[model samples]
Target: MRPRFVLPAAFSVAAILLLVSCNRGDLPGKKQLESEQVQASPVAPVASSKVVEELPGAAVSPLTVEQRLEDFDYMWKIIEENYPFLEVNKRLNGEDWLANKEEYRNKIAAVKTDDEFFRRMRFVLSRLNNGHTNFLSKEEYPWYLNTYVQAGFGYEPWINVFQQPNVLARYNQKPLAEQQSPNESNNDINSGEAGSQTGKTSGNVKKVIIEPDQIAYLGMRSFEGSLMEMDSSEIRDFLIEVKDYKTLILDIRGNGGGNSSYWRNNMVPLLINKPITYNTYSLYRGGEYAEAFMQARWLTGGLLPIANIKDEQMPNIPPEATTMFKDYNKNVDIVTPYQSVGFKGEIYLLVDSSVYSSAEGFAAFAKGTGFAMVVGGRTGGDGLGTDPLVAALPNSGYVFRFSLQMGLNSDGSCNEEVKTVPDVEVDPDTSKPLLDQPAIKKVLELAASQ
Candidate 1:
């Protein structure tokens, strides 16, 4: 445990003076602020932010000096070079991680054991408050308990404990899984900690007939597997059946992401006759991770934005950060190779906070191109980039993973920050059971209106 030291009362006056000379035109951070008038301040303001900085966790065992300086330095270099969400997290969560480089290094230098280093690294990631990135020291560090599969089952116990608590909630500040209601197929898939394996190969789209042929519904429980890979005619026949429906509601409320290829091959070819496109943008440092990701995806085109994307919520790209652009015309449009029957009627995507990764990517594609009317709640983002990149500490050999790409939309807003917004916002009626899916009624009403 790190000791908390309150400065003497007399030192408060001096601390205020120094802070005012420093802090300029910035919003108040997570610290408790008391408004006060400052004297002899010209260039800067906001004197009351004389913060009692909370220290990160300490090692349990006593260890040698200079324990892991090189290992930490290597990690810091990678983060500095590639990570794009640093500024976004700072503005949103009030965590200026780059400013506290030495503080984290000092914590790593005194780590008594390998376990302590892992814990300390997790604390470092906690400061970022990101769901896509994490220090994967434990095999199941990200497991969640998703009980929303059925009617009687309620929320998992840990939902009240860790997921999206107050930013300054000390040790509880890590970006825990934003777990929510899951499909029966995704009950074990999302609730990974409970040791239920709803892996890709088995889970398929469940069909629900809302109003016979007039209004149809399909529950895309998880994008973990391909409709083509299962060697089944069920998904194929279902798509062929609903391809001509007047209005189709694709429910992805509890769909946790798996593979981009799942829908890329299955849904896009069969449903999207006219190409659905969005201006895709990416930020990267041309590191090994970026090279491999681009090459693996066979990404072939890019150009700089007309102006350096200036958004208040977006990251202020450093001089070293290169903006990579993707042409949605070629990438998202798949017609010549795979002939699309294309759903002629209106397609409405049903989403909630639980819709994430490739699942959220589907919602984004639908929303971005006006292919589907996005209904229900806003989606979980961090969906536009490739899978996370992994690296190992040279000395300790402890491996971890983090996101290297910061995907953006056409309007220069970050997908990770803005997420996928609904065209028709309908809040889920939490009073009802999870299995009831109360939001669908309003979504259907709104869809018919439009």
Candidate 2:
């Protein structure tokens, strides 16, 4: 018998979104919601033994040639062992990664200063062309921390980017007469305005209101926080507060994704009415790592003793062995409504190039299921890979992260190769705020009609 696995609550939301396999937790029945609220697990802090220190005026120590080479080799080895999209990457970029590795390896030997070494390492990782695969040096990681504090992490940046004048101008340029065609029935008067009424929900959800229309807007800058951290009850209440509106505009523009479970357990359930099959299938690359993962489960009490090899289906290897194409198989997932009752209102989803990883997955799912009308630009196309495993260099303390599996679309398409196209395509003007854009007005008009 294949041992039944229960989804653990300890996993980070980021990990949960990146690794779909990890989200196979048992779903609570409808009655469960009436009985009590689902409690979220606390997120554990990542522990590192070697603390990176900062010196204001201390002498800068440059990495020696040997240390640089060692760090480069270690980073390269981690990717070689685990990166799941080597074949897809090659096909997309038309570059021989292995050959480039040798070329870059030679270049790394000549890099002198720590700055040069870090830059070179980043350049090498950029060859993968994968947003999830990256190198974060100890010196640079602090910038992220400082920036998050100053700009409110992901939220402020999204607001600043989408609210630019140039961005709003692009939307405003759409012919008002064209928008008011005979086929359109909504009594939407062109406001000719370019700003949104912004507020924060009790849950801290950034709410935007376009004037003259009751359309409710919510922006998901990232899926980073735990469901509890996000205040699920507040979110539910906010939805309830806006449930009477004609439409709900979900703006995920520039959302670089964090955790799928947050949306899955909290947002998704509230939006959906009936049980729907969102994820048709997921493909996993089977190899020594797969077997090792399975074995480790047994030793770690994650698998039952009765589990046998016959239950394990071998992966079908592709013809390109050098490209790391191993056996691939599919898995399915089904989503049901969270509460016995749900929001029956129309939903509009806003997407853009920065909408990546789990956000991309959510967009794909929402679009595939006809759950919402996706508007704006194509998604970032970074959701097709599995969760990344983080590794630190022995000498420089630079961290390398890479995916172990590749996720496929509902139709067995690679999301990394093909972006999720919107139902209504709108070219955003980067110079303006998203609220000021004409697309928001169009979406509002459509929502009013619905």
Candidate 3:
């Protein structure tokens, strides 16, 4: 319930899938599947009861013929019941999701090994074309962690500068005569600052660099650890330090995203001077259990005591719950800016397709409020959905996560269908380091402009 997949750490091949596998609605008793299950409304919950009954954590093992079939059935049923955007996704991608499931289910019996089974499972998930929905075999998880988690450092310009001395020299050795040229603007307040000030805060914010031009750059790799594990005071102090810069560049390229609170509560307030209303409405399947989960999550600040509750104890769902299923018609969240000493200088947000989930949410807020000029490629369009619920397959030990609510922009546009477009779209140059990339240069140019 702690805002599923809120950080870039969750951006692993398996991680994104796992974070989005679970239903955000409720852990209800698995209902019987309808003939046309995909078209059914208020799709049944994945059998929390079955999960509790079958696996018991001791019985789960590698794939057997029967087990593989069961796993396929389990995965398909759960997806059919809880996948939030089958209709929209079908329309957008022109893929027959239900038909794909049936096709994949037939192939399950032919799978000879766990690896093959995993491939088939992945194929089924891939048909959704959703980055958030995914599955990872137990064997694949370790490799995923090693490859993605260890190599999670994305594009950080300041880091590139130190790692490549030539890049530093290019920026630093610009002629002093040129620095004082009549055509140059005096808007760069701390132009005399000598070396770049670079350091990683305990809060996962790496490389806070104040260049000689007084353009402050803060590089954040993932938002997950920084907001939850670190102290808010650290964030406040970091904001206080960078508040004096003439221009601030928040680099979140390749940022997988984390908890929305990290930006909503901590970052947004520091960027905007006034309160702004931003909408991120979501639609969940209507049911008593789902309603209870929604109400509980809202009341507890995104936490739900799912393990403690039984179906009978679920409160009666409100009559309005029926109307809530009208996709994109949900109420708007009028978020008020947090009170703090915020930076009112020119702001730029650096992004890439890897920026997703909570990170994408930050981009949406920044773009929607006009708080910052976005620069870089389109952000990963993964925010327009509810945080997913995770479930473990009883037979295969593979975990699956998926969203249960479709998220919408303030104007009721589907984020899954439309990515967050940057004001200045500059693609990264893989041939050079991040600091030497054209995007960073463009950002610096914008920063230097009067």
TM for every model, in the order presented, reads 0.64, 0.64, 0.62
For model 2, the superposed segments whose C-alpha errors exceed 4 Å read 1-16, 19-67, 139-204, 209-214, 226-228, 280-323, 384-386, 394-397, 429-435
* TM-score between model 3 and native: 0.62
Root-mean-square deviation (CA) per prediction: 17.5, 17.9, 18.0
Number of the top lDDT candidate = 2
lDDT for model 3, please.
0.52
What's the CA error at residue 105 for candidate 2, in Å? 1.3
lDDT of 3 at 295: 42
Error of 2 at 362 (Å): 1.1
For candidate 2, what's the RMSD? Answer: 17.9
Model 2 is weakest, by summed lDDT over 10 consecutive residues, at 187-196
How far in Å is the alpha carbon of 326 misplaced in model 3? Answer: 5.0
lDDT of each: 0.51, 0.53, 0.52
TM match of model 2 to true structure: 0.64
